[model samples]
Target: MSKEQTLMKLSAILIAALLSITSVAAFSHSGGTDSKGCHRNHKTNDYHCH
Candidate 1:
């Protein structure tokens, strides 16, 4: 393979990895209600009774 081809492949791989990481981070949940009746804010990560 040529140097250009190898670079392109590496760039594609890096882009794919970054996209996957970003997607996981975007969908990650920080705070939420548990089994009991409760609530929590994602931003504050604080739990409270409902």
Candidate 2:
């Protein structure tokens, strides 16, 4: 492919990757924890400590 075409494709891939990563990180959890600062992942039923 041409240089510009390759760069555009790479940029689009990178942007999509970054957006997915940030969105998952931003909304990974939406629950309240107990006094020990831990919560359960309802989706996976796994408990984690923070």
Candidate 3:
């Protein structure tokens, strides 16, 4: 309701969003896995980026 309270809430929401994005990178796997149709290890495959 108040200006100060509103700013505080906005900052908290921003921080939470930023942290969630950073956390995603931590769990992310950079290496691609070989699948039924695609051999990620082969040089010819281009389905996904590692």
Candidate 4:
């Protein structure tokens, strides 16, 4: 493959990866936190602080 084509492919892959990562924030569940600023993860049954 030519250098230009390889660079284009790499750029496209990088953009796709960044997009997928940023999209994860949109899926965060909205919930109430305790007095200590911690919440329970319903899916995992785990408690954590933000």
Top-TM-score candidate index? 4
Provide the global lDDT of candidate 3 against the true structure.
Answer: 0.72
Report the C-alpha lDDT of model 4 over 1-50, residue by residue, as the tens digit: 99999999999999999999999988856668899889987889999886
What clash count goes with each model?
Answer: 0, 0, 0, 0
Candidate 2 clashing pairs?
none
- Winner on lDDT (2 vs 4): 4
For all predicted structures, in order, the TM-scores are 0.54, 0.52, 0.55, 0.57
| True-structure lDDT of candidate 1 | 0.80
Cα distance off (Å), candidate 1, residue 2: 0.2
Task: Quote the lDDT for 16 in model 4.
Answer: 100
Q: In model 1, how large is the Cα lDDT of residue 10? A: 100
- CA RMSD for every model? 5.4, 4.6, 6.8, 4.4
Worst 10 residues of 3 by lDDT: 32-41
Predicted structure 2, TM vs. truth: 0.52
lDDT of 1 at 2: 100
- Minimum summed lDDT over a 10-residue window in model 1 is located at 25-34
Q: Cα miss at 24, model 1 (Å)? A: 0.6
lDDT of 4 at 11: 100
